[model samples]
Target: MTQTGSYLYAIAAPVGDDVLGGLRGVADEPVRAVRHRDLVAVVGTVDIGPDGPFGEEALAQNLSDAGWLAAVARAHHAVIDGVARAVPAAPLRLATIVADDDGVRDRLERWQDGLRRTLDEIAGHAEWSVKVHAPQPADPDTDPQPAAGAPGAGAAYLLRRKAVATARDDALARASAVAGQVHEELARHATDARRLAVQDQRLTGADTPMSLNGAYLVPVAGADAFVATVEELRERYPDCRFELAGPWPAYSFVTVEEP
Candidate 1:
């Protein structure tokens, strides 16, 4: 028998009954809200039995598969964004599961006051992601053209390689310094800021390695200003490109355990 569990995504206050009408969650199951007092928990059923996609038996394997993780994350974010847009909420950690709706209600009741305060902290803010990348050296196979005044072989080639290495190091150092400045500038206009670990090009789909991966909690009212500042950053750092995404569901700003 396939045993199912309730997966919790976010918590809000008295969410509209019809808010999740057409929404789906893990495994494409219909989403519903579990309520206790004046609070509601957005939830959906996820199988936790052997052979189930999200089952504990296969949890490690599933996490190792990038495609599966991405699909699930997308679904989770879609529902979270929907609820956040309609009303303020505190997004739960990824893949938080409970045995059933009763478990969901119990947990919500236990954490009611703390969770409410978490919601209040992020009431007027959304998270925005910013990344900066420094371009990599041109590929030799595809371009076949090295920097002007190229060295063919022998002593000149060795010296050229040494110089190239030094230049690359310098560029990376400069990129790091600039990334710090960018974060400081953005943080000035944000309620709070968090510097996430830099991401690999493979994960970010960027042309160069990332120097900064930051998330800023910008007020909903000041979202336009945040975006404008990002544009200014783009111009300010020509050697390193900047990318901005979201008005995301206050994911980075809320913690259920927070005071």
Candidate 2:
């Protein structure tokens, strides 16, 4: 027989049973609500036997399999994303499972204070992702060089190299400054903002280099203005390309304590 565990997707303020009706979670299992005090946990039953796919040992191995990870991640996020649409939800890390409802209650009871605060913070807000990519730095033109072993040949070569390096450095510095300006301007329109690490060219699959990867928490009412600000910045700074995606759950701002 497959031993089962409760796979927790998110925590929210008092979700009614009717709200979760017909909703499915990980493994295509029926979603249910487990309440503790004023908070409710969104969960689904999942197999976690010693040899089951989600068994601790097997889970570690499965995470390394791209296809398996992607499938599970999609399912997990789907549940959280759905719940978040109806309530101020604080999502748990993917694959958070416990022994049973009692365990889920224990987690809720233990984190009630923090959970309530997080819920309050996210009640009327959503997360937005913004990326700023700059055009690739232009290659420098080379000046005709003196023949090797000629007088002052080495000196001229050293001077040319130094000039090229300085020019490249200056270009990068300018790009960085522009990125900072854009982030600052956008922050003015957001309730909270986070600057994430820039992605590599290979990961972005773009010829241009990424200068800024940012997350912002904005009020639902201000969402339109926030998007407009992004568009405005795009026009104001033609040298940098801006990409915006959002109205998602406050993934970057939610401070849920791990079980």
Candidate 3:
């Protein structure tokens, strides 16, 4: 007989039968809830083996597999979206599956209060990402130059290089300052904020410089105003690039409680 594994989707408030209906997980498996006290663990079925944890060397290997990772991510997002429509929810990290429904029940019993607080805090709010980039310094060869052997040619070249370096440094410093200002201003309008990894220029496909990459949790009511504030800041700092996206699930803000 083939052994089975429990695929954990998300933890949410106890949802009604109607609310839980019509949702699917990996392989189009119908989603089900494992209830423990006031908490519910949305789950689906997977295959586990007697070798312990599945047909893999270790838990890490199983978790890192690309196809497995993608399935879990999709399942997690799907359940999170469904639960969020009905009630506030705290989405677990991708591939947070355990051996069976019992493990989920244990977790729910263990972390009930913290989960409640997290859900309450995030209710009716969503996350947003903002990234800023600045233009790269102009190349030296592109600059107008005097003919070779002109008076003070060597000295002028050194002086010009020094000036260019100074200007680049100054621009970088200004961009940093502006990024701080933007973060601070946005924080005032958001329930929570975080600084994320700065994206590399090559990845961004722009000669523009990246000054900031940040996430913010904003109430639904405040989203329009928050966007307007960002637009105003963009106008104020015409030299830098300001990009914004989302209204996504609060992935960055959820905290896992110790069991």
Instruction: Give me the candidate number with maximum lDDT.
Output: 2
Model 3, 88-123: lDDT tens digits are: 777777656687888878888888888888878888
lDDT of 2 by residue, 1-259 (tens): 8999999989987776677885787688899999889899999998899888888998899989999999988888888888888889998889889999999999888888888999999998999999988745555547778888999899988987888777667656766887899899989999899998999989999777788899999999999999999999889878677889988888888876665
Clash list (residue pairs), candidate 2? none
Q: Looking at model 2, which ten-residue stretch has the lowest summed lDDT?
A: 134-143
Every candidate's CA RMSD: 4.1, 2.8, 3.2
For each candidate in the order shown, give its overall lDDT on alpha carbons.
Answer: 0.85, 0.86, 0.79
**What ranges in model 2 sit over 4 Å off?**
142-168, 257-259
lDDT of candidate 2 at residue 38, scale 0 to 100 = 89
TM-score of each: 0.87, 0.88, 0.83
Decoy 2 TM-score against native: 0.88
Clashes of each: 0, 0, 1
Model 1 over residues 17-107: C-alpha lDDT tens digits? 6888868886899888888988899999999888888788687798789998899889899889888988888888778888999999888
lDDT ranking of the models: 2, 1, 3
